[model samples]
Target chain A: MFNKIYAFIKRDVTIATSYKLSFFLRFFGMFFSILVFYFIDKLFGSTATPYLMDYGGDYFSFVLIGIAFTSFLWAGLKSFSKVIRRGQMMGTLEAMLITPTRISTIILFSSIWSFIATSVTALLYLAIGGLFFGVDLGSANILSTAIVLVLTIIAFSSFGILSASFIMIYKEGDPINWLFSSSSTLLGGVFFPIEVMPDWLQSISKILPITYSLDAMRLAILKGYAPAALTHDILPLIGFSAIVMPLAIVSFYLAVNKAKMNGSLTHY
Target chain B: MVNTVEYSIETKGLVKSYPQPRNFFEFFRGTEKKPVTALDHVDLKIKKGEFFGVLGPNGAGKTTLTKILCTLVLPSEGEVRVNGYDVVKNGGGVRTSIGLVSSDERSFYWKISGRENLVFFAVLNNHSWSRAKERAAEVLEIVGLESAADRRFETYSSGMKQKMAFAKGLLNDPQTLFLDEPTRSLDPNAAKEIRHFLSSLSKQGKTIFLTTHNLAEAEQLCKRVAVLHRGRVQGVGSKRDLGRMLTRGERLMLVVSGLEKPGISRLETLSVVDSVGVEGLGGGRVRLTLELAEGSVSTVLSEALKLGLQIHSTRTEEASLEQIFEKLTTEEV
Candidate 1:
């Protein structure tokens, strides 16, 4: 299993490196976006916002962490569906499906390289924030941050698999991707804290796993909260992973079975 | 030999159907469509270490059967077992025991090298990285792609891409190999090479179940062949048996220049001739096709000579596999 995963990563890395310009362009694109955010942070003049004061005193650091975490969230939430779409387009999906590996194993391993790429982007975000934007991570709790990151990835990837199931069956017009992407971006506290929303809207935000993930990450990275003190955010993320991962797996299995019964597994 | 051989693949009354759209507005009305049968009660048994062929025209369910045997598609209403394991209950087992090659050239990642693609698939078959690399090299060499192993698959010509697909199928060293039109896109030379390679693999005791529209290919590689038409197996046997099923006698074509009416009547009186067809060719020449019962070619020829019919050419022909396939598929059962 490890060897299969390693092979998938190696293949993706080789392909990624082949397009030298695009590979370097992505980093440059992310770097310039951070610089844009840095100027916006200056416009806010270091005034402590009510929503961010508890997590961090500066908008720059708060939004930087949010951007970094959301990058991971995007990778986790889109990787599986993206791979499925590519497989279908390239006509490799049936070839992969006919292998001895389980469907879940294929989905999981195919997304590993995307997650690794996002992790590097996340690190670059932190580096740019610290070196030029005056963001501080000296007080960060590395162990607790790692735990939050893992749990968050698990929860987000569950939804990714669900989106991939839709792709496998529908071939186009996946409602899950649109619904999840819009809702999470609007309500998951990626830009400002959810407290700024109306009371009823905040209730909607509370139900999203990304909300808890971003909150936990902020508490660990900015507030330096210990694992015990981070229970409020960690518990929901873990609970989401535990419940949704199985559901995603079952949904994907059923989708595959439906395709098989319809004799459309290899059809685009 | 087939009767006593162990079976590697068996399907009992297998059926598969796909839902068909009712009308253009059916999607908006949320109405269900009727189902169209792709395979109706297909029962097949392939012996271990035997090279088997399924010959059919387009939309004849050859590909559907191959997909079901490879565990990529489900049989709607029957049991399918590959290598003693049920396809549904033990798909992983079946998958591990079988390798598949289809005509689709886009199955490999276009951006990756041919070696990378093979190694990745080998690893997916549960080989360690080192072993996968070794096996990938071995199969690449076997398929004659070792020199171009490091080139991106997208850069390969269509024939080279097909060879790479063959290499990928051999990566697992599977017990049984399923090939669906494996030489469909190849030029004659490449196609012949693949045929030779597959024949060698059969000699090594690997069970090969091939589906193809090329009758000559089937005739060359398969010891036994099944003809499928309209989602049903028309006939299943060796070339001789299938030919015998279609005709109990022989067909002979005689090109001759006729002299008189009595000669035709005299030739028709021979005891061996079942039926005769005469078509006028211009310039006082005629083509006579004689359908005779078995062991009647010599008698018919002698009778024609005794009739004093000036023979331009005499050719003895038997029922070919192509003729048998055409007769069986075109005629209603």
Candidate 2:
């Protein structure tokens, strides 16, 4: 299993490095987006949003954490389906499916490199925020932040595997991608606090695992909340992972069987 | 109790059907679709260490059968077992016991070198990193790609890409190998080289199930073959047995000069000749093809010489594998 994970990471990194320009361009793009948000935060000054006071009272810090954590969430949520789709297009999916490894192992291993790359990007976001934008994280509870990040990744990966199941069966035009992308970005508090939304929308946001993940992460990273103090957010994220992971796994198995029966396993 | 099965592959009444959309607007109308049967009912047994060929034209379910045995696709009905493990219930066992080399060329990571691709697949099959690299190197050498192993796959020619694919299949040293048109896009020399490699592998006690449109290659490489036509097995046996099945009598071709009407009439009158065809060669030469009953070639020739026909050349012709395949498949269609 460890060998397989290393092989997948090596393969992806080799391919990524082959396109040197694209490799550098991705980081450049992320940095430019951060600069845009930093300038916007400068224009808004420090006393604008009162909701930010609960976290760090700095708009740039609030939005930087939000952007960085949501980028991590996006990577975890889309990596499985993206890998499946790319495998189908490249005609390697059937080859991978015929191996002795379990389907769940293949799916999980395929996404680990993406998660690691996203983690590095998230750290870069934090470094830029601290150095150039005056964002502070000196008092953050590191252990609590790590726990929230791990839980959030597990929870979002479950959703990603479910989305990949749809791609495996449908082959094209998977509605799961659009549904999750729109709903999660709009209500998961990536750009702003869900508390600012209408009452009914806030109720909807409460149901999303990403909403709780962002909330817990901000509390841990910005306000230095301990694990015991953030049980309200951590419990739901854990529950979501525990329940959704198995369900998504079962759904992925069924989708693979369906594709096999229909002789569409390799069809793109 | 353990089951002891002699055959490497066994399929009884295996059937596979795929659902087809009713029409272009079926999705909008939500209409019920129909199923198209890819394999009607295939029953086969391939012995251990035997080189078996599945000969068929396009759309003959050869690929479907291969896929089912490789455990990449499921049979809609009946049972399939590879290495004595049920394909549906114990797919992992089947996968571990076999490897597949498909005709599809896009199955590799084009950006990576051939060695990396093989190593990656080897690790996926549960090999350690060191073992995977070792196995990849060995297989690349076996497939005559050792020098080109480090070249990116997209830079390789079609035949080189195919050899790389073949090397990947051999990475695990599987007991049974499923090759679907392994030489489809190769030049004649390259195709011959691959065939020789497969023949050597068969000599090493590897069971090979090869599907090919090239009848001569199958005839040269396989000990037993099954002819598939329209998702059905039309015939299965050695080349001689299939030929005899299609043509129960022997065929003899006679080239003669100074053939006359009386000579033809006399040859037709011979009791051993079942049928005779005469084509004029326009230079006082004629070609006579005589279908004779068993053990009648000598009698026919003697009778022809006594009738004043000067025979320049007499040759016996058995139906080639291509002829047998065409006859069997076309007759069924």
Candidate 3:
């Protein structure tokens, strides 16, 4: 399993680096996003701090963690299906499927590189924010942050697996991907606190795991809260995982069989 | 179920059908669409170490049968067993026991080296890292691609790509190897190389199930073949067996000289001769065409000589696979 994962990551890394400009542009794009937010932080000044007091009372720091962690959210949500979509277009998905490997394993191995790149970029966000932009890292509770990140990824990955199920069958334009993903960016507190939303919108936000994910992440990383104090956020993330993971698995299985029956496993 | 000891693949009343693809407007209108049958009530059994071919024209369900046996697709009805394991029930077992060499050339990661792609697939087969590399090298050597193994797949010519696909299929040393148009788009020299490799595999006691529309390729490579047309198995047997089944007898042309109508009448009346026709060459000689019952050529000729006919020339015609395929697939349902 480790070999498969390593081989796939290596395979992707080679392909990704082969396009020299695109390879460098990913990091360039990462910092470009940070620059825009930094300027936005300067413009807002201290106006947003009142709502951000729970996360160190600094807009830049709060927004930095929000964007950095949601990088993981997007990775967990989009990585599997994106790779699958590319595979379908390139005909590599059928090549992998004909092997003895399980579909779940193939899904994991195919996209492990995306998560790794996300992790690297997320750490760069932290390092850049801490060194140049004055974001706090000294008070971070690493264990609580790890637990929240793991559960957050699991919750978000359920939606990804569901999205992949659609790609496996339809080959493109997976409906729920656009739905949950856009919903995450809009309501999951990646840019602003969900607490600022109107009460009805906040109610809708509560159902998305990312809302809990970012809330728990800020408390643990900025305020250094331990797991016990983070349970309120952790519980909902767990709840989302329990509900959606099984559904995603079942949907993926059905989608695969449907494609098999249609004789379109290799069709795009 | 295949006995597993004597047979490598067996299918009983196998059928597969796919739903017609709907357009955007049709999907919204909720139009009821018909399913297109790809394979219809096909039955076959292939012995262990036997080379079997499926001869078909395009859209003839040859690839569908290959996918079903590879467990890449499931049959809508009936049973298929490969290497003693039911394809739908124990697909993992069947997958582990068989290799598939597909004609689709884009199946590899084009940006990666051929070696890397093979190593990746070998690992998927559950080999250790060291073993995977070793197997990759071994198969690369087998396909005579060792020199090009380190080059990117996109750099390969068509022949090299086909050979790379063939090498990947041999990684696990599967008991039964399925080749779907393995030489589909290759040049003659490349096709001959693939055929030679396949012949060597067959000589080594590996069962091969090949699908192709190339009649001569099948005749050269397979010992027994099944003819698939319009989603049905029109005939299944050796070339001779299919010929006998379709024509129902042997065809013989003979040149003989005898004083006319009475001899033709007597020959037609003989039990071995199904029908007889004589045409005079205007020089006291006639061309006698005879359709003899299966295995009755000797009997008919022996009886002809006893009747005091001076035979000048004789020729026997056995139907070619192409002719038999044409007759089987093109005849009205």
Candidate 4:
């Protein structure tokens, strides 16, 4: 099964490497997203700058981490769904589905492929965003931040798989995928603190795993907090992982089994 | 020609169904409709090293049965065994044991080279990278695509791509090969080359199960053939056995010199001839065709002699597989 996973990842990487224009677009897109969001923050009367100063960090640094994490994680999850959906559209879905390996393994392999791509973009984001914005690049808890990022990826990607199940079942009508990609970015505190929202929306956003991921990321990068300082956020992220990962995986399993039972596993 | 080896693939009462749309709404909501029988009680046993051909019109359940045996699709009802393992219970083993070649050229990544596609599938089949590369090279050589191996698959012509697909199927050196219309859209020369390659594969002790709509190709390559229609096996046996099933025997065609169109009745008056058909007449000659009952040629000749018809030339022709197929598929018996 490791061999299968390895082959699956290798296949995606080979195909990804072949698309030079798309690779460049991914890099440019990551850069453009940060620039766009920074200007948007400026237009808000630099309301966020004084907030970051009060927290003893540059406002640009605060939002840079946010931009990096959200874009990177979003790209990782989207990569799996986009590539797999492309395979389905091209009628190779049956080929992938019929393989003896578990469907989760295939999804995992593809998500990891995208995760690597996202990580490269994140590194470039740090380099260019730091140089241009003159933000003090925080590294007080870099290792712990990296670990949380990894766990957050695994957690969020599992939910992405669940979203994929929704896609498989509904076929084509509305753009549920767009709803997934953008909704999470907007609601999960990628650009601002959910505390700034109304109480009801804040309560709803707190339940989202990305809310905790963003909180922990801000604490680690801007607040000079160690892993121990992240206990309030870390515990919930772990809880979200425990609850959502299995739910997502089981949902995917159920989706595939349903497809098989209905003879729709290969249906376009 | 089949070798003297044993049977490798055997199916008993294999049946499969796909959901069929009964109405427009059901058509829009596909897979919610009534089940359409794709394979209805198909029983086939293929001997090892045999070049078996499955001939059928479209919607004849050829691909359905192949997909079932390869474990790509589940059989709604039936028992199938490939190399002694049940397809449903031991699907992983079955998948690893058999190779499949579908007619679709888009199955592989178009952006990757032929070698990359082979290695990817080989690795997925649990081979090491080195072993996968080695196997890819070997099969590429076998399919005569060594020169084009480095080029991306999208650049390949249909024939070259087809050959690469064949090479992919052989990556595992599978004991049984399921080829679904393997040479469907190729030029005649390219198709002939593929047929020759298939013959070589059969000689290597590979059990080949092929489906084709080309009757002449089947006649040239298959030792035993099965005809499918309307989700059922219409006929299944050696060509000789199928030919013998036809009641009409020993069709004879005569190109007589100095004969005219009016000779149709005189030819029909022959004692043993069941029916005489005048195809055409040209240059003071007639093209006469006769369908005779078994062992009736002698009586037909005597009757023709008695009629005092000039017999410039005569010859007896056995029924071709095409004729036998046409008779069986169209007629009741």
Candidate 5:
């Protein structure tokens, strides 16, 4: 299974490399998104500057960390969309489905390549922001931030696979990508604090778990919160992962079985 | 069920169906729809080390049966077993025991070389990387693709792609092989090469189940052939056995120059002769069509000689597999 994963990852990475312009455009596209957020922060003036002052971190640094973490989280979710949509366009999804390996393993392996690609792009954005944009590394909770980043990615990817199962069964025209993009940008606390949401929306935000992910990541980067400081939200993230991961796997299996029953598993 | 000691594949009343939408709304409602039966109670047993060919026109359930036996698709009703393992209950084991090669060679990653594709599929079947590479080399050599194995499949000729598909089918050295139109798109030379290679492979211990519309290919390669038409098996047996099933068995068509008359009564009255007719021929030569008992060609010849008529040329013709297939399929629907 590890070998299968390795083979798939290597092949996909090579495939990504073959399309160099697309890779560079993806990197630049996410880079400009951060630039837009940076300008918005600048437009907010002292209102945003004071909040970072209270947190004892630079405002630019805070937004950079937020964007980086959110990028990886969204990257994890987008991995499934990439596999489903691009794979369908390339006529490879059915071929990949016919393999005897479990779908979860293949999805995981296929998505790992995208995760690595997105992470590298995120790292490049960070480096460029830190070097040329005067973005500081703010606090020294690097280890905690890394741990939270990994956990949040796993949680988001579980949901992504769940969404991908729906795509496998019924193609909704990339609605999951649209849903993830808009919701995470607006409600996931990517550019703003979740506390600013109204009570009802805040309650919904609390249930989302990505809000907590961004909060924990924000605290770790700005306030130098210990890894245990995020422990309060860990249970909820674990709960979401626990419930959604198995549901995603089961849904994937059911979808594949349906395809097989219909003899569409081999259909291009 | 096939006896474990003698058979490699068996299907008992196997049936498969796909639900057809009743109307447009049912597509979204996911309600039950009328099902289209692909295979209807197909019962077959293939012995170990036997090369069995399935001959059918398009949409005749050959692919559906192959998919069921390969464990890619489950039967809606009945049971199928491969290598003594129930296809439904022991699907993984059945998958491991058999190798399937479909017409869709494009399923493999086209950018990768043929050798890499083989190694990838090999690793999926649990072979080590070194073993995969070694076995890929062996299969490439076997399929006569060693010279071009390192080239991308996207750059290959259709025949080369087919040869590579065959190589992948043999990568795991599977005990049972299922090939669906393995030479469908090949040129004559490549098709003949694959046929000979498959024949030699079956000469080894592997059992092969193949589907093809090419009757001559089946006749040349298969020890036993099953004729499928309209989603049903019309007949299943060896070439001679299927030939005997037709009403006009052991037919001997001749164009004799020595016939004095177009409808010769002496030729009609020959012993073992079922019917004799002189079909039209130019320049006074008569084309004779003779029907005889399945094994009585020699008696018809001697009876013609006893008439004291000089025999210019005589040729005994048995029903070709092509003719038998046409007769079986073109029967009353």
Candidate 6:
């Protein structure tokens, strides 16, 4: 299993880096976005906002973690379907499935490179912020942060797999992805605190895994909260994972069988 | 292998259909349209070491059959087994025992080297990394792509990419290999190279199920061929045997000398002779073309001898594969 995952990752890395200009452009764009966010935070100055008081009241640090981890949300919710769509367009889906490798294994491993690349981008965001934007990570709690990130990925990946199920059959126009992505950006505390929203919208935000994920992440990283103290966010993320993962797996399984029957497994 | 079963590939009553679109009125009335049947009741059995070709025109369900046997598509009806594993119940087992060579060259990553592609596919087939590297090189050499193996796939010619596909198929050393239109769009020389490589693989005693529209390729490589038309198997037999079926009406050409008008009639009266055409030669010798019903050439000869004709030479003209394919696929068939 590890061998197969490594092989796919190597293949993607080779292909991804083959586009030399696009590769460099991505990094440049990452820095550009970071700088844009830094300036906006500068306009706010050192003025403390009540919404961010729970996490050192630094809006730049709070929003930095939020926007950086949004990439993870996109990776989890979009990578599987993007991989499938790319495979279909590139005409590699049949070739890949024709191997003895199981379909489930392919789906599970197809997004590893996306997640890994997203992690690097996320880390780069934190590094740039800490070095130049006056954002401090001296109080970071590594272990608690790692646990929340894992659970967050699992919870987010459930939605990703479900979106992939729709992509597998429909070929395009995945509804699940748009619903989660737009909602997560607007209400899941990515660019702003959920507390800043009205009471009704905050209730809606409470149901989203991203809201808990971002909250726990900010508390752990900025406030240096211990694992024992992070249970308030940890339990809900685990519950979401426990409930959604099986549903996603079963949905994907059904979608694959339908594709095989429809003879559209390779059809685009 | 093949569960000790003699046949490497087998199918019974196989059927596949694609759903059809309905009109607005039909949709409103809930009238379901009949699906387009791609394969209708195809029954086939291929021996473990035979090179079998499924001959068909475009849209003839040859690829559908290949996909079903490869466990890539599910049959709407019927049972399919490859290497003795039921395709539906044990697709993984079937997949493990078979390989595929698809004509779709876009299947490979354009940015990677041919060797890199093969090694990755080999890994997918459960080969250890070291073993995959070894097998990748071995198959690349077998396909004569060693020199070009390091070049990116997009830079390779059409022929080279097809050969890389072949190398990938051979990575697992499968018991049964499916080649779907293996030489679809190659230049004549490039196609001949692929055909020659296919001949070598056939000699290695692997069961090769080839789907092709090229009658010459099938005739040259396959021992037995199945002609599929309209999602149905029109006929399945050795190429020579299929040719014999085509020749049933006009079986042989007998050139003779010293045969007269009376003798031609007498020879025609024989029960085995379906019809006889006599063309006069200048020196009172005539060439007789005999179409036989159910008798040996010797019987025709003896009967012609009784008619006081001199036999010069007899030639049994076999129908070309093209002619047989045309006969099988035509609507009249």
* Cα RMSD (angstroms) for every candidate in the order listed: 2.9, 2.7, 2.4, 4.5, 3.5, 2.9
Q: Model 2: residues >4 Å from true position, as ranges?
A: A45-47, B1-4, B22-24, B28-30, B255-275, B282-286, B292-313
- Once fitted onto the true fold, the runs of candidate 3 whose alpha carbons sit more than 4 angstroms away are B24-30, B255-289, B302-310
Q: What are the fnat scores of the candidates, in the order listed?
A: 0.88, 0.87, 0.71, 0.29, 0.33, 0.86
Candidate 3, residues B159-188, lDDT tens digits: the string is 999999988888889999999889988999
1 versus 6: better DockQ goes to: 1
**What is the per-residue lDDT of model 4 for residues B1-333, given as tens digits with 9 covering 90 to 100?**
222235678788888877653666766776365678888899888887888888877887887777778775677877888877788778787877788787788778898889988888777666887898999999999998999999999999999988987887887888888888888899999999999999998889898898888898899889999988777887887787676556356777766665544556776665566777775576766667888876777777666666566677789877778877787666555
Best by DockQ: 2
TM-score, candidate number 1: 0.92
Candidate 4 collision pairs: none
lDDT for each residue of candidate 6 in B10-118, tens digit (9 for 90 to 100): 8889999988757779989999887999999998889999999999888989878888898888999987888889999999998899999988899899999999999
What's the TM for chain B in candidate 3? 0.91
Instruction: Kindly report which residue stretches of model 1 are placed more than 4 angstroms away from their true locations once superposed.
Output: A45-48, B1-5, B21-24, B254-274, B280-287, B295-315
The deviation in Å at residue B230 for candidate 2 is 0.9
Ranking by DockQ: 2, 1, 6, 3, 5, 4
Query: Please, what are the lDDT tens digits per residue for candidate 2 over residues B1-333?
Result: 123368898888889999995655887798886788889889888999999999988999999999999888999998888888899999998888888887788889999999999999999888999999999999998988899889999999988988887888887788999998899888999888888888899999999999999888999999999999888989988987787676556889999987778877887787777678988887788889997776789998888787777888999888899889989899873
Indicate whether candidate 1 or candidate 5 has the larger TM-score: 1
Q: Under CAPRI classification, how is model 3 graded?
A: medium
Chain A vs. true chain A, TM-score per model, equals: 0.96, 0.96, 0.96, 0.86, 0.87, 0.97
Instruction: For residues A1-268, write the lDDT of model 2, one tens digit per residue.
Output: 7889899999999998899999789889878988888888789846547877778677778778888988777787789988888888998988887789877787789898899889988899888878877778887899999999999999988888888899998876667667767888999888788877999999988888889888888889889999999999999999999999999889999999998898888788
Against the native complex, each candidate's DockQ, computed on alpha carbons, is 0.79, 0.80, 0.71, 0.36, 0.43, 0.77
Q: Where does candidate 6 chain B have its weakest 10-residue lDDT segment?
A: B243-252
For residue B205, model 4's alpha carbon misses the true position, in angstroms, by 1.1
lDDT, model 5: 0.76
Clashing pairs in 1: none
Name the candidate that leads on TM-score. 3
Clash list (residue pairs), candidate 6: none
Q: Rank the candidates by TM-score, best first.
A: 3, 2, 6, 1, 5, 4
For model 6, the stretches where C-alpha displacement exceeds 4 angstroms are A45-48, B1-4, B21-31, B247-250, B254-270, B274-290, B298-313
